[model samples]
Target: MSFQLFGLPVARGVAIGRALLVSSSRVDVAHYYIEPAQIEAEIQRLRMARDAVVEELETLQRELPGDAPAELSALLDVHVMLLQDELLGAATKQWIAERHYNAEWALSAQLEVLARQFDEMEDEYLRERKADLEQVVERLLLVLSEGGGGRGRAGGLPQLSAATGDNPLILVANDISPADMLGFRRSVFTGFVTDVGGPTSHTAIVARSLNIPAVVGAREASRLIRQDDWIVIDGDAGLVIVDPSPIVLEEYRFRQRSGELERERLGRLRHTPAVTLDGEPVELLANIELQSDAEAAIAAGAQGVGLFRTEFLFMNRNGELPGEEEQFEAYRGAVMAMQGLPVTIRTVDVGADKPLDRLSIHELRQEQGLNPALGLRAIRWSLSEPSMFRQQLRAILRASAHGPVRLLIPMLAHESEIRLTLEMIDRAKQQLREAGLAYGEVQVGAMIEVPAAALMVEAFLDRFDFLAIGTNDLVQYTLAIDRADEAVAHLYDPWHPAVLHLLHHIIRAARKRGKSVCVCGEIAGDIDFTEVLLAMGLRSFSMHPSQIPALKQKVLRTDTRRCSVLRPARGVPD
Candidate 1:
């Protein structure tokens, strides 16, 4: 029988392989009480398990490929921290001694409490931390149950490799941890599908880095997929066909070959400059979220990073903000890795969709009837919280000394906000100078995302050195649609007349001011819109690393002058 499932398309590719269902081992923990005499031994056993898990994670980190994405190493670091958490260590021991429970039982109890706390979190990103907590606890339980010797089945991935017998397999799981994915890094899995995780989840990021087809948020994929069942995964379309018939399989096989041929053609253009047919050069850059992404960006021929989102540094950890030094190290690392290419670092854009639990604003987030997207966020949040803003600004300033670094303020809508942000940057520079710190001259830029920001182009042009249009948010706000809400996702159209008008105005205004303009949003990566954007005088584009080659190919074939002459009118098809 033929059936299909839909999910969020994350990494792009196509794969047809037998299903390999890998179930999480966390739910199989045994629980029991312990005798008074066994309490000390149980505590000792817990300590040994913690030590062993830490050792295993450290070994995995060391064994990671020299060129592996930095996020993998960072994920390992988070796991190690969770294993050594004071709550997990101290509270579990307390539970064991006072409740007379065995080590595994005590650990499971504490994990339940922690999981409940994470579940209560309103922010989806923070709520996902529950999975990390479970992953760490599961590892400890495995170590304790197996006498601290065995590898706990490698998250059931070894079974996939053993059953396939040289045939490719698609892994289906409720969720996959970084460690589990690492175990199968050298395996013969052609793709993966998960019941959980969004486009920006760590698993999706890792899958993209490994160039594997992946579909996530496929609820119940693991529950429905049986081992060795024929399956087809289309990562580009977010479709999974199970027990596919001969006809569907043949169609996908044709698509798979077409995709491979196109990729091969694009691969040959990696070293080519993104210049138009008329010999005009366009600056092609990458929007990076991690230091490891910088390597991939450069490898894909990105001139530099046009948008380096710093928000990832603020997520997926316990309730704590990264300090100034930590922020500085991250910014400096990206700068150094770029090898002098310009790196635009955007300040924390948390609010609405992403809430930081450690900040006082988190308490305010609990207030009913609050619209996060419109509420205090981006530059608005930064201005409201001067101290935190200053810390990030100081870190960015210190990092500027390393190489070409630019400051990009997000969600700016008013002259007042721009003025305040400039004042804050000046104050940070003063603080740096007073401390006798050496810093390079960093250009300041503004993200023209808000509709108000797009309207008040003169104010921004008069203030900032350059401008970057974030079409993703601009279109959503302009069209009064929430792109993340699937109920209205179909209504979120970038080609809408209002959106095109706003993009045209922003690009023309920036050019009039003689300031560089770059598009660092999803639209920038869309090959269909490349000619339209070029016709509108957009000279720079920043997108995902994987998207560059294809866009560059489009750019090379584009004749901007011809596009301008043949540009479509409002409500007219081109």
Candidate 2:
């Protein structure tokens, strides 16, 4: 019987493959008591498994492709940390010795207790981290059961046979760990469907980097499909079809070919300028989170980096923030790599969704009610902590000496906030001058994400050198939707009338004031909306590196003068 399942689409593409189902309940360990005389051997067994898992993870990290997303390496680093955790190591051994329980049983018990603790946390981000704890425990349990042979058939991943047909395999799992995905590098899986993970998860990021078709958060996918069942994954539409009929399979096959052709056409435009038929040149930039992404941006032919999110430096650091030197080196490396292309670095935009656990400011978040999105974040949080803010500003200033750099302030809702941030930038420059340090001219910009800022755009035009519209957050705040919340994700529409109105107003306002504005959000990367945005007077677009080619293809083919005459009521293609 053919059946369909839907999930969050984290990566784009389509695949037809045989199902490779990995059981989620593989980690269910049996409780058994061992004699006190056998405790030493059991403890040694547990130690050896932990050591094996660590070695495997380190090896995976070492073998990761140079072109892989930087976050993939960071994910492996987190796994290595979990294996080296004292609680997972020493405490599990203590439990084994005291309770005379099997190593797997003891580890399972510890994981349950820790997971319960994490479940009770007030912060949503930290609560979501419980999955990481579970993933590591699952890996340890697998190693212990498989006798540390390094995760092959015994680990539940299918072994491709030489006699098998050429059909690709679609991996279905309750959840896939970054380590598990890394282990499959030598395999020939075409795509993956998981019952867990959001768009921003490490799994999703890695999948995108690999250009794999993936549908994540597909509840019950592992249970619904059996191994060897034919499946179709429409990653662009977030659809997973199990035991697909011949007609449906043929339909998807056509769509897959069309998608491939489209990609090939876009690939041909790699060096093409993003200009409209009327000779209006649009600047295409890339939005990157890590310093390593500079290479990708250049490869994608980005004029420069429009949005260089600096938050990744603060994350996965074991509660330790990156110091000034570390921040300086990262910024300088990115600046130098761009080779005169402007890199707009936005300072720490952490809070609410992204919390800095080590900072004292985040501790007060528990009292901020259920809505942390509206609470202190971005520029507000930076202003509250001057020392941390100054360190980042100084690093950015020092890096500016290397090449063209721009400082961007996020979540600016008030004029007072912009004034204060500018003053701080001046303060940072003064400190550099006092220290006899040389720095280049750094342009300052602000993100027009807050509805308040969008409406009061005139006040900001004179204060900031350039403006960038972050449609992702603007839509969320305007529609009162939590974009990350799957339950409310449908309501988070970029095409909402109110959202379009606000976008039009901001872009028009920036143009009227003779200030350059750019769109640096998901909408900017969406090829379907490229013409609409261009018609709406958006001349600069910034998006993910992978999306630049397709968007540029659209830009080159668009005649903005004709598009400006077309209205939504005229049945324009979306």
Candidate 3:
């Protein structure tokens, strides 16, 4: 009997031929342990493999069709960059040489160390890159054991489908990395299932991008499916079927077709403006970490860039500060990519989530506090490290010469912090003037993440050029719920009366002060609430590039007045 598993709805395409079935198996945790000599050997092996992959990629670049997708080239470049990452290579080697342990043990130990590093990063995208790092390490280790050389593919489930026909749906053991997900042939594959992954996991992102039905954290969905078992997948609901009854199969076929038609309908709006029914205009901007992401956003029809996370430049790095030139390049790239659209780059918001180890090591900062989010981080961390903060500000000032750019300082709680930050910006501008460097008049803004920042909105509006409400932290702090904790994630509701009350106040404050207020949190991307946000007099929102089109379409259909008519219920006040 055959079974089917569902995944995130990426969209739909015709099934080619065969599908890949994943079976679950267990191994002891000790098997992942790494030792010293093993680490050294693994590094050596990885270097050699990296070299070979680089050469092959260069060759492909030279010979490939000029019109070939740039993503192919980008994939190869990412491989080269990973191999060159000193932290991954050096850190692993250090453990091996110092501890003299086996390769598996050493790698395992190093992974924990890497995880700690990831946990300290403030940028969500960069923080998520830990998944990529973990996947890379796994692949490198497998290569060494298999006696293969030169960037071999990931090992786990077999690729069961053929190119001539549709590919089989795939199921995986754990969360799939972006690289592995990118390698899937969308036309051949139907859908996928995994034993591990969450809504925000890389696998989910990939599944969404590819428009495939995917089910994650199925425990042992792989074990339940047999080879060649005819199955159906429902991506929207994240459901799966094992030897599904005839009725269910028929239902899925109808759903699959209807889903495809609906997407086709939505596809038309990809290039259209996201105006609302009553002629309310909403600005849809993209949130990005890497410069390359800007291109993706533009392709998706974003008006401009918002929430350019600058932390990726600092991650997996050994230096206390990224060089001014490097920062300028990153900033300039983003500005130019937007083709004159406003780019708001959040200054380095290092806190418990994003920790600079070298700086922390030298500063002797300890994560001993009971609550890390409230501990020294974001603006607090910057205030602690003046030199590091200055370097970033200087870079942004220089990069501003290229295009419209704004600096958004995160986690502002007190009026003094904003005053101090502006003072530093003045000093930076003065220093640049003295040095005869050309720069632009840049806008300074603050992220309203803390309740203190929210309460002092009028003061902040008076001080800053703009305000971007970070609902994630605002909701978390207000509800006293750590959204990271799964047990309490449910409680971290944005729709809650308290959260709505806070949000309304912030918007009203911004408007009263005649300053622009935009939402850069996940809430902004929600189709369900786009109207509500606009109704609340919020005309600007920044979200992931993929979210821009839908939000835009929602905006074009919604009338500002109609949306505003709906007031907050009794518990919530507008």
- Model 1: lDDT to the true structure: 0.80
Where model 2 places Cα greater than 4 Å from the true spot, the runs are 15-212, 222-231, 242-261, 357-369, 567-574
Estimate every model's Cα lDDT from 0 to 1.
0.80, 0.80, 0.67
**Model 1 CA deviation exceeding 4 Å by range:** 7-11, 16-230, 245-254, 357-370, 570-574
Candidate 1 TM-score, C-alpha based: 0.70
Query: After superposition, which runs of candidate 3 have C-alpha atoms over 4 Å from their true positions?
Result: 1-148, 152-235, 238-264, 318-321, 351-370
Alpha-carbon RMSD, candidate 2? 13.5
Q: Local error of candidate 3 at 143, Å?
A: 7.9
What TM-score does model 3 achieve against the real structure? 0.65
Question: By summed lDDT, which 10 consecutive residues of candidate 3 come out lowest?
Answer: 23-32
Cα distance off (Å), candidate 2, residue 509: 1.2
lDDT (10s digit) by residue, model 1, range 313-355: 7764556778899999999999999998999999998775565
Tens digits of per-residue lDDT, candidate 3, 1-574, equal 5555554433323232222343222211112223333555655655665455556557877787889899777765665576568876676666446644334434545665666578689999889877666666565555454544222223332322232322244443444434345445422456676666545444554455445666666656645544444556555666667666778767777776776676567667767876667765678888877787788778777788779878757754545468887998999998998898889999886654445545454244343435556678788888887887887888899989999999999999997898899998998898889999888989999999998889878888878899999887888789887544434434657788878888989998898888889998877877888867876789889887766666776777777776666765424465
Instruction: Give the clashing pairs for model 2.
Output: none
Q: What TM-score does each of the candidates earn?
A: 0.70, 0.70, 0.65
- Flag clash pairs in model 1: none
Put down candidate 2 lDDT per residue, 1-574, tens digits, no spaces. Answer: 8899999997899988877555333564543456678789888988888888889889999999899999889888988887888877888887678756578767865775566678789999889877887888888888877784222342234433323235577888777644345435446688999887766454665577566899988888876666567899999889998888889889999999998898777777778888887899999998877788899899889999999889868864557888999999999999988989999999998875666656445556556445667788889889998999999999999999999999999999987898899999999999999999888998899999989999999988989999999887898899888655556655667787788888888888899888999998778877878877887788999887888887887887889988876546433333
